[model samples]
Target chain A: MDILHALIVLANFIIVPAIAYGSQLALGALGITLVVGVLRFSNFAHGETMAFGTMIVILMTWLFTAIGLSIYPLPTALLALPFGIIGCIAIVLLTDKFVYKFYRKAKSTPVVLVMASLGVTFIMNGLIRFIIGPGDQRFADGARFIIKARDFKTMTGFKEGLAIKVTQSITLVTAIIVVAALFWFLNKTRTGKSMRAYSDNEDLALLSGINPERVVMITWIIVAILATVAGTLYGLDKTFKPFTYFQLLLPMFAAAVVGGLGNPVGAIVGGFIIAFSEISFTYAYKKVFTYLLPADWAPTSLVQLLSTDYKFAVSFSILVLVLLFRPTGLFKGQST
Target chain B: MTGGYGTGADILHDCTVAVNKGEIAVIVGPNGAGKSTAMKAIFGMLTMRSGQVSIDGEDITNLSPQDRVAKGMAFVPQNQNIFTSLSVEENLEMGAFLREDDISETMHQVFDLFPILKERRKQAAGELSGGQRQQVAVGRALMTQPKVLMLDEPTAGVSPIVMDELFDRIIDVAKTGISILMVEQNARQALEIADKGYVLVQGENRFTDTGSNLLSDPEVRKSFLGG
Candidate 1:
C-alpha cells in the first residue's frame, strides 16, 4: 500500500507531466525539423509563430465564450483551432513571400537565412505582444479530469489515489494522430517524396523536374499547421503566456538537436527524453523513497537533482553536450 | 552552341551534336573541353547564347528544364545524380513525377534493366555501391519514357567491370528506340559503342563522324585515342 502511494505520487509529479510536456515539445520540434530539413535554415521565428497562432486561438476562444458558444465539456478553443491555423498559415506564407523568397533567389548562405529569420522573430514577437499584450491567459474549459483522485481511491481502495487530467490524455491522443498523419503524408504521397528529394539534393530535384515554388509553399503550409496545433495544445495544457512560448524555443530546439536535427523520428524521441529528464531531475523523490525503503532507511534530503527553476537550463546543458560530442545528433542527421 | 555560367564568357563554342532514334552519340574530350557543357546546352540547362536546341523537330530552347522533361527528354548529371536518401523505388518514382498515367509498367522495365536495383528496391540509393548508384541514376532517367536520354559521365568513379556493365545497359536502353547522348572520359570504350562520335577540343567540335570512322581517322587517333 505504501509503495502504491509512492508510485501514485511519482506518476502525478513526473510521468504524467513529462508525457504531456513531451508531446508538446515533439510537435514544436517537428516544426523546427521540417523547416530546417526542407528550407535549409534554423528558423528562430518558430516560437514567435507559435505564440502568434496561440494568440489568435485565445482571441477566438474569448469571442466564443462571450457569445456563450462552446463545445461544452471540451474547450471552445478546439473549435477555434482552425482559425488559428489559418491565421498562422497566412503569416508564414506572407513572411516567405515578402522576405525569405528574395534571399532564396539570391542563394544566400544558411547563416544569412538564420539571421533573416531572427529578424522575423522580432517582428512576430512584437506583433503578438502588440495584439495580445504580454500576460498569462487561461482558456481551458473542458471536464478537468478523466480520472479523479477521490474516485480512484474509492474504486481501488489504495492509500494514494491517481488522477489523470483530461488535457494530458488529449495531448497524447492528438500528438499520436498528428504524427501518424504527418508520417503517412511524408512517406506515401507523391508530393511528399518530391519534398524529400528536394531536401536531399536541390539541383538534382530541379533536374528531376520538381517545381521549387511548390515545394516551398507546401513546406510553409505544413509548418503553419504544426506550429498552430502545437501552440494551441501547449496553451491548453498550461496557461497561455506569450513570453512562455518565446522561452519554449530553447527546449524545442534542444529536442530537435538532441534527437538529430532534421530527423522526424529523432525529434519525437528527443522530446520525450528532454521532458523526462527535466521532470525527474527536478522532482523531489523523498516521498517515493520513503514508500519504497524500510522505515528508518529513508533519506532526509528532498532528493532533487535540480530545482524546477532551472528546467530550461537542463535543456540547454543537454544541447551543449550533444553538440560537443555528437554534432550530427544521435540519429546522424544531414551534416548541413 | 555558345554559353557559359551566369554572365561569364562561353564555355562551349560552336559545338553541335545529335543522335538519331536508337543511336548512341558519344562526346569525348579532355577535362575543361566543355564536353558536359555541350550536353547541358542541348538539355536546356544553360542559356545557349547563339544556338537553338530542338528535339524530334520541336524547338525546346526556350523551355525550362522541367518543361523539357514534359517534352520527353531526360538528363542524368555527372555528380549528385541520385537522391541519396531515397529508396531505389522512390528514386524511380520521382523520375516519373510529371507523368499522370500509371507508371508500374515503366518501373518494372527499369527493374528489368537493373536487376540489382529490383533486388534492393527498398534500399536507400546512397547505401548502394557506386556501380549500383549509377544504375539507379540511369534507371531513374528511363522512368520518364524519354525519347532522348542524356548522360553526363555516367561511369565516373566506377570499377572497370562496373563500367563495362553500365555500357552494356546503356546499349540495351538505346536498343529500345531511345536516343542516347552521352559525354565520356573513357574515349576508347565510349567510341566502341558510339554510332555517332563528336570529339570536342577547347569547346569546339574537332571531329564529327561515324564511331568507326573516328576510330580509324589518323588525326582523331593521334590526338584523342592516346595512340
Candidate 2:
C-alpha cells in the first residue's frame, strides 16, 4: 500500500514545515506572554514590534552583504541578529518611556494601556513601512537545504522525497535554546523571580522592595530579545515583509491565547497546535491518500479541508472557540 | 499623621500609633474607620500631607514604599498578599528580595515557625487553603527579618479556628523580638493577645492603653469590645 511513500510525502509537506513554523510562533507568543504577565495588558503592537525588529535585521543584512561580510554556509543575517536585537531594545524602551510610562504613572487602566498599545501598533506599522518600503525583503543566504529532496529520494529509493531546509533547522535549534534559557531565567534567577513576583502581585512585590521601574525595564528588554529572535528566524525562513509580520499578530495572539495568556509553557504548546492545524487544514491530502489506497479506490479530488487563503481562519476559529469555552485557556492562565 | 489615598479626604488625622521592640500593638476599629489606611500611611503606601514616619528616629517621610522595605520594615496586605503563582519558598525568597546576604538561615527560621509552609514550600501559594495562604503571607513578610512587621487584617476571611491559630503565630512572631503592628477586625481576640491596643474611630485615636486595661475598660468594652 506504499505506506512509506505516504509517510515521506507527509513529512516533506507537513511535519517539517509545521515544526519550524510552530517554533517561530512559540517565540512570538512568548514575547506577548511576558508583556501580558508583567505589564498586565494585551499588547496589540506585538506584530509590529516583530516587524520592526526584523526590518532592522534586513537593513543590517543588506549592509553586511554590501560590505562583503559573509558568514557563508550560514545566513549573514545571523551575524546581524544581535544588532537588530539592540535596535529593537532601543526602540521598545524609547516607546515605553515616551508613551506607556505616562499612562502607567497616571495609573491608567489596563484597557487604556491596551488601547495605547494599539495606537503604538499603528505608529510602528507606519514607521516600518516608511523605512523598509513595505516590500518583501529576502535576507536568507546559506546552505539552502540540509538534505535535498532529490538526494533523499536517491538515497532511500522512494518515489516521495523529503527535504529539510537549513533555515528550518536553525529555527528549531534556536527556539529550543531560547526556550530553555527563558525557563531557567524565570525559575532560577533572582531578578526573574522578582519579575514573576511583580506579575503575580504588584502591591506585594513593591512591599517586598522590588522596584517597579526596574522590573518594567527588564520586561521590555526580555520582550525585545524574544521578538527579535522570533522575527529574525521567521524572516529567515519566510520572506521579510512588514505587512506579513503585522498580519502574523493574529496567529501569534491565537497561539498565546490558546496556550494560555500569561502562561509561558502554554505559549509553546499553543504554537505547535496552531501551526499543525493551519498546515493540515490547508494541505491537499490527495497524494498521501493516493499512496495509501489501492489503485481502484484512488480519489480524483484534492481532499483539502480548506484553501490556503483560509489558513489564518483556523487560528481565528480556535481562538474564538477557546474564548467561548475556556477563557483562562488550556493551562488555566490569568482569567481576564 | 494625616493622609488619605490620592489626596482624598484625610482619613487619618493626628493618628499617633507606636509599637515597642518584641511588643504587639493592635489597631482595632470598625469598617470605614481607616484602620488599614493608617497602617498603609505608616508603611508609606500613601502620601502623608503632614506626617513623619521614622525608623529608630530616622525620618522616613520622604522614602517610597520600596525604600521603606530596605529600612527593615515588612508589610502584609489584607488581600493579594502573597504571589499566588509562586511557590511558598519563592514567596519567602521574594520577601528577602532586598537582602543581598545569605537568607538560608532566615528561611530555616521561617520554616520552623510555620512548619506547614515548609511542607508546602514547593506548592503554588494560591493552591493552598486560606489559612495556609495566610501563613505563607506572614512567612513572606518574615523573610526580610525586619525590626517592624505590619499586618493589615492578617486573619481576614478565615474561620475562627484558623484565626486562633494565626493569632498564636503572631504571638510567636512577636516573641522573636520583632515589633508587630497589626490592624485587626477581631477586636476582642486581638486585644486579648496585644501588649498595647489603639482603638480608632473615624481615623482618630479614641482609646490608647495597655491591652488588658482597654479590655477591662467598661466604655471600650461597651463600644468596641462588644461587651
Using TM-score as the measure, the top candidate is 1
TM-score of 2: 0.96
iRMSD, model 2, in Å: 0.7
> Which residue pairs of candidate 1 clash?
none
- In model 2, the runs with Cα more than 4 Å from the true position are none
Output the worst ten-in-a-row residue range by lDDT, candidate 2 chain B.
B43-52
Candidate by candidate, in order, the iRMS in Å equals: 0.8, 0.7
TM-score of each: 0.97, 0.96
**Candidate 2 displacement at residue B42 in angstroms:** 1.3
Per-model RMSD to reference:
1.6, 1.7
- Evaluated on chain A only, model 1 obtains a TM-score of 0.97
